[model samples]
Target: MSSTALIFHIQRFSIHDGPGIRTTVFFKGCSLSCFWCHNPEGRHAYSEIQFVASNCIGCGECVYVCEHHAHQLKDGERFYSRALCVNCGKCAQNCFSGTLELIGKRMTVKQVMDEILRDSAFYESSNGGITLSGGEPCLKSVFIRTLLEQCKQQNIHTALETCGNYKWDKLNSLLPFTDLVMMDIKLMNPDKHKQVTGDSNKRIITNARQLVLTDKPIIFRTPIVPTVNDTIEEFSEIVDFIEELIELRLKRGKASTNDANIQLELLPFHQLASDKYKHLGQDYKAAQLIPPASEKMHELAEIAKKHAIDVKVR
Candidate 1:
């Protein structure tokens, strides 16, 4: 019997995920349908096909390989008949320029840990560790917990970047082995959260509160999207929520009265996902949504500073 994990990517030498040089494992599947998702292809739990027309030399190799006649050129435009395609991957196999590609891979836990431990020297030197990110890591709690446990066995520091949408018990079970927990608070208002993410924020908010009560090192990340959650009122609500959590910890004797440190990071929006969406054969609806200007990002950093939360715009 072998333990396997369905992972989309294994990014090495990642400095932004946590402290030092770390390896980030991007798991597939997510519960929320955020409009601004960078890895839209990773949102699905299975492998997906991606086509890049520019890379095609019009060799018609894919047309010959696809048994279902899914590949066709009409009016000199390459069109994919997704309905008829069986995802046999024969077309991608026949592509020379890699105009067509597949996005997900299945690996056993031992295979993943082997790759992660290769950087053990780097982790020891920089205080870096393994960061499991996702579509929503909590959704794959069993795999995540097993992976984290293995990291612990190897004396590797472990971190999780989550959306905080899982049940409290499920999340709490992994905390003992996890060194740091990074979570996002997308929207405080329920209706606005639903309108933007197509899901309610109640579960996410509740899980965040429960996680913070454990008094573990937690970093709250908020994506600064324009005309959505980049308002002063939303920032204020976030601050208030943190303040409430601090109060709860005090009442429970979990924190000292003077220790008010809360790590928070504000991530500005970017158009990096547009090309990726195109590669995945998905529509890039938010391609025009530009990132905030440097000056505006600085202003928001100042606003977050006023709340006494250490804020970094990455």
Candidate 2:
């Protein structure tokens, strides 16, 4: 098993990811290409350089330092060629304007634990712990398992933020160390799911069914995208699935979601990551999609509440 993985960021004191304040380890790489993904940098499985044109000062320092001619100044404007860039990071290192950035870093379990131990006290006090989030943390399952093993040894609560597209065995092994599981159920129709996320929902739904049998806490999340799955009928299909899962757990003599062990969280889409897409030289195809108003979220939450499970709009 590999001990190191490509990590992009470690966000400390994160309140929204899990039960309490958490230290979220953001890994690089994903299986899905959700149109409204906030972390476009995490999409690639390898390290990448991000350039923000608006942040450029036209200092030509990057042009002066680039070895591959990736950075060029033509018509008094700086241009970056992703095809020519080799990710040596020399130009990013030399650029003084913070315009260029290397997004991913290779981290060992030991190195990551050093950072997690920093907030041990907060974890103990707030019921918060370590949450592994990513492009898809399971993409580096072996590495995540090692890191999560370290977390469990420390008696810290462990959680996962996954897309549920991996094979059942891949995720099953990590559940022993995970105290909570947060998986996305973006779309119900397999074809529609493939249309938006670039993958069929077959494996995801299979995982969800298997996950329901386990006693581990689970949170099913559906991001509310405007033109994608905003309708009551569409959203209700997801809620109906959750209700069925709760029934499945009850049949197995496990705690149902009604007892708070399982729940649904609705996340509204936002353009906060618009600039992130720009930085990554990728277009935000969902740019024109408007955010659902607060009242709309409340309405959806109410629609979800019609089921036996607890529903909350985040």
Candidate 3:
């Protein structure tokens, strides 16, 4: 196997990423630049630094360690001058407390599998498996495919959380080894999709259709952002699109009557990425982006239920 991936984090004991408890391998790099991305650090494929000023004790340790004077204290507050910083990671290495941190690391398939296998007992007990997520796993197709092959060799269930923005060929290369594909359907309107995600929806929709045709288990995830995609009409359009797909599959004899049992999950947006953006020296455009109200979430669920599609809110 060849080394070809830049991974950000390998989160263990994660319950929400997939079934039961899972070890999620977050790949670095993304095709879309969504306005309200939660994992901003994973957007870039290269290594980057994050400054968490709260963790800093004002000991001026980073300033002393930075030969380039990338860090300095002004008015008793430490400020990081990103322009002068070389991302050498010397400050992070020398800091006693985790005030400065580095994000994104390169890892090979063998190395990541070792970490996953270490927690095999937990995966077995909880029906958990390995989930490949990221900036976009499809960006590192070769590495993902190899990682999935190794996991299957160990009898580990594999899942992928994707933005569904890749070409059909790129996605199909990994589906045989993937047990579950959890994808995000950001918007149904092509122009609006581009406006919000910085990419057109043609590829995403095509890939999703192909996945459904393959009879692979797929979970459609929609993030409910506040002014972007949080209207009843928007939700209804998504529900209708999914229903149409099922209907089309039935017409083509690709799906059984029981296939109507497929469910769509609605994920309410949250502000978890606000601080992460600041840490990465990026602006938070959606600072006031609030999650949908509880009543609205239930209302959307009811709407999907009326369409005879199972709906879950998380």
Candidate 4:
């Protein structure tokens, strides 16, 4: 069989992913189970259906097409039973209002490149290119490397958004073709990190140390979720760690004052993706948590700025 990847979405004209307007290719299958993950649909590797209850008009359109009896109308209301569904995409195919939809699609590098090339003009104009994000792109290492190689051949700028929890061998192979690396550092405390994200921070920290040794410019991100790395002291500790990496790069002569290749971005957590859990039949863990205030995010940004590194809040 040929190389195939389960891609969930292709977000076009994205700004926050990297510099300028870009197209973000979201891959499926994540190793971590972050409780506050905004993109829960990407956690699984297989193709699944996402149900948007609000969009369902109870028109019984899906009921007629689903051979597995995954969809039914009860008292003029649509009732979806995921247990019987085999994910053949028959019901989702008939969903016009996007009430029942498929999340992941199997595609090859050439197929995905067709979509990326469509926005080449926008990328060149905005100094933006293709960004591989999502359910941890590194989990699909070989396939990602192939796709990145194709992008390099086409002279398309490439970036990888990763969780940095995988084995180094997997990520090291893709680094050559990647232009920029965006990695998340949600929590510093190992115990707390495992509790929230369902994985230890040991591999993450080790991988980060290795990333600093390379010449690749990296942006280590921390999503400021309330009750989780949102305090000033904890944030400061993370900044201190980043400062250490910067110092290492400088000591090794890989960077100077002008070309400091390290940056810290503080991302504020929100409950906007609560519906994503409802769609995927999972609990919204960040449901009870509130987003930090704008002033607080700025305060944290200022704290990080005290160190000799770049700090951004969003």
Candidate 5:
């Protein structure tokens, strides 16, 4: 296993990520540049600095610690010079108030596994395990494969929450060890997908279709973004595509890839990521967007259910 990979966050006892109380390891870096990215800090492959204005105490500790003079305090207000900062995390280290933060770090596979293993008791009791999530966990194929293999050795359930925007081989390589795959289908229209995410949906769609052919339980999710894919027609198109994949798999006589193992999930859009974008010095493109109402989400779920697919709004 590779000794180190860039990691942005590790959320423990996370129920929304997967079944029961799973620990989610967020791998740093993403192939797509979605305009409404929640984890802007994780979008970058390398380490970056984040500033929290509210946490600043107006102390000059960071200014004293940063050799690059990246931290500047004038008239009690703090200003950061991003150009001069090396992202060495010195300011973050000195900021005891949790104002300055270093977003990503390099950690070995063993290091990650050890942290996941800490919650083994909870996993065994709650039928929970480890979930590999990220800016896009599929991007770190080999590392995730190794980590999942280790989890399987310990009889831990493994789930992958991915964007499904990688090569087929990378997704294929990890299928054997993955028990559940939570894939995000942002938009159906290729042109609209590229326009919003800065990447074509061809690879993502292909990966999803291929994943349906495997035995692992698959949950297809779509974040209900207003003006992007909130309309019934957009979600209806996605359901049609999934139904086709299921039909093809059945025709192939792939017993494991039955429709029963496939599920549809609808995630409502939220402004939670807006704060992260502010910390990263980037504007939140979807700041004005509001989360879909429960009725709207239910309507979308009903459409998916009409196709005989299990649907949930989470």
Candidate 6:
């Protein structure tokens, strides 16, 4: 049988994902469950039903269409009974009002390639291509490798946005076809990282160390969460770590100070995905936290700059 992956979303014409314009394919499943994760729907490995209550309009369409009686209208409000749902996608198919929706679907490599190839003209004009994002794209290593290989066959530039929390062997297999790797370093402290993200930093740090050794360009990103991993001390430690990695590269004659193969991008925290949490029937733990002001982002950028590394606030 042809290999297929469970994917949550395919965002097109995206400027923030990579250079110029790009299409970001969000794969389902992840190793970590960070409290502030924006895409709660993407975390689960299996397909999930996302119920948007406000959009239902107390419509009985889902109840009528679902053969399993997974949906019920209770006192002018809609409720989705998870126990009865077989994930047949029947209710979602008839959901014209956009209340009940399936979050993930299986897609073959060829099927995904066709979707991205449709925007070939845009990619050519803007010097952009396909980017595999997640729920940790590396989780589905074989599927991602095949997709990356296919993209390369078509001369499409490929990038991977990862949290850097996967097995080293899995990542090594994908880099040969990847042109750029944008990884997130959520926290410098191992214990704190484990506390918030529910995973230790050992694996992520190790993977990144090996990733930089490769020829592909690397972009180190961090979502600056206030009172979590955002502190002057934390940023200083991060810069020091990057400086050490650059030294290692120089020692091996793999990179130079002027090479610009590595860069840092600080992503400000945002509450934009709070509603997504509600839709996914999950709590938005960071609801009260506001996005860091531009000035604050710049202030941290200055700290990163002091290490003589190219840094930007995105």
Best by lDDT: 2
Better of 1 and 2 by TM-score: 2
The residue-by-residue lDDT of candidate 1 on 183-281, one tens digit each, is 998778999988888788999889877876786788888888887777778867876776676676667765563464457788888887888887776
Model 5's alpha-carbon lDDT is 0.87
List pairs with backbone clashes in candidate 6. none
Clashes of each: 0, 0, 0, 0, 0, 0
Q: Residue 24 deviation, candidate 2, in Å?
A: 0.4
- lDDT for position 219 in model 2: 90
- Per-residue C-alpha lDDT of model 5 across residues 1-314, encoded as one tens digit per residue: 36688899999999888888899999989998888877887788889999888988888999899899888898877889888988899789888898998989899889999999999999999999999988888788888889999999999999998898889999899988999999888888999999999888999888887886776788888888898899988888998987887776677666543444777788888888888898888878899888889999999989988887778888
- Native-vs-model 1 lDDT? 0.82
C-alpha local distance difference test of each model: 0.82, 0.90, 0.85, 0.88, 0.87, 0.87
**Best to worst by lDDT, what's the order?**
2, 4, 6, 5, 3, 1
Question: Which is superior by lDDT, 1 or 6?
Answer: 6
Pairs of residues clashing in candidate 4: none
- Candidate 2, 1-314: lDDT as tens digits: 34689999999999999988899999999999998898898899988998878789898988998889998999986789999998878888888888898889998888999999999999999999999998999999988898999899999999999999989999999999999999999889999999999999999999999998898889999999988889988988888888888888888865544664788999999989998888888878999999999999999898778776787899
List candidate 6 segments past 4 Å from native. Answer: none
In model 1, pairs of residues that clash are none
lDDT of 3 by residue, 1-314 (tens): 46858888999999988787899999989999998998998888787888888888888878888999999898987788889988888888888778888787778788899999999999899999999999999888988999999999998989999999978888899998998889998789999999988999999888877777776777889888887778888878888887876675667665564664345888888888898999899878788877789888888888888877767999
Error of 6 at 152 (Å): 0.8
Q: What's the residue-level lDDT of 307 in candidate 6?
A: 83
Cα-based TM-score, every candidate: 0.93, 0.96, 0.94, 0.96, 0.95, 0.96
Comparing 4 and 6 on lDDT, the stronger one: 4
Candidate 3 vs candidate 5: the TM-score winner is 5
lDDT of 5 at 82: 83
